[model samples]
Target: MSVTAVNDVNFATQIRKEGATLVEFGASWCPPCKVLLPILDELSEQHGEKLRILKVDCDESPATASQFGVMSMPTVIVFHNGEPVEKLIGLRPKSVYENVLAKYS
Candidate 1:
């Protein structure tokens, strides 16, 4: 599976779906955010059955980003049952994300 891109319009609906959702708030101009894209794609494919990975461009979807209190370029929020359970800032190793997903999955 591939990471789905969400904007303010569909952000709520997508994250509120019936499973664990990992939403990454980022912008195209950020270097770290660019780096994390492939990582997120890999994660989506690896854990597709148990996890739903989504991306929101902070530059384009300011409403969703502000609502989540995302201050950094790459803020990763793990949502379970429509509520945020964990948040990670900046660039992190793949294993770190895997560990976080372990709790929800």
Candidate 2:
């Protein structure tokens, strides 16, 4: 599975879905956010069965970004049962994400 794009309009419904949801708050101009895209894609494919991966462009979805208190590009928040449980700031190694997913999966 590939990471689905989410905007302020649907962000609430998407994250509220059953199971673990990983939301990446970023923008197109952010270099690190660009680099993190492929990693998220890989993660989506690898953990699709156990997790839902979504991306929220900060520039395009400012309201949702602000609601999550995302101050930087590539801020990743892991949500379980509609509540945020863990937050990862900046770009991180794939293993770090895998470790987080393991905790919730």
Native-structure RMSD, model 1: 0.9
lDDT score of model 2? 0.92
Clash totals, every prediction: 0, 0
Per-residue lDDT of candidate 2, residues 70-100 (tens digit) = 9988999999988999999999999999999
Regions of model 1 farther than 4 Å from truth = none
Residue 96 of model 1: what lDDT?
Answer: 97
Measured over all alpha carbons after superposition, the RMSD of each candidate to the real structure, in angstroms, is: 0.9, 0.9
Clashing residue pairs found in predicted model 1: none
Model 2 poorest ten-residue lDDT run = 10-19
Model 1, 1-105: lDDT tens per residue? Answer: 788999999888787556799999998899999999999999988987788889999999999999999999799999988899999999999999999998988
**CA lDDT, every model vs. true structure:** 0.91, 0.92
